[model samples]
Target: MAAKKKIRSPELEEGHLCYICGKEIHGDHVYIKTRRRSELHIHFECMPGKQQVN
Candidate 1:
């Protein structure tokens, strides 16, 4: 059997533009920001993954 892929968020489901490189990724992507306290909108490489290291 083939593995099922994760679904993207609704905000980016249709399509998302990256802030850093202006890249576009479809499903199973991630969204990230340089600063945690940043109020500015950021969406680089389409989106970021759920895996976070702190």
Candidate 2:
């Protein structure tokens, strides 16, 4: 059987923008997450990005 990787503890910090939309977000409502351990990425809209011109 293949080896399993261990997940480290959750790391969070303020001003952590989303990797998707580059929006500013907090660990509160509409936070960021991932199934794998990459970067604590979030949505661009979730951080601080350009709003819709609508």
- Model number with the top TM-score: 2
TM-score of each: 0.28, 0.31
Residue lDDT tens for model 2, 1-54: 999998765563456666666666665534545677555666545455657777
- Identify the candidate with maximal lDDT: 2
**Model 2 CA lDDT for position 45:** 52
TM-score of 2: 0.31
Work out how many backbone clashes candidate 1 has: 5
Report model 1's TM-score to 2 decimal places: 0.28
Point out the worst 10-residue segment of candidate 2 by lDDT.
25-34
Instruction: Report the C-alpha displacement of residue 31, candidate 2, in angstroms.
Output: 8.3
Candidate 2 lDDT (Cα, 0 to 1): 0.59
lDDT of 1 at 14: 57
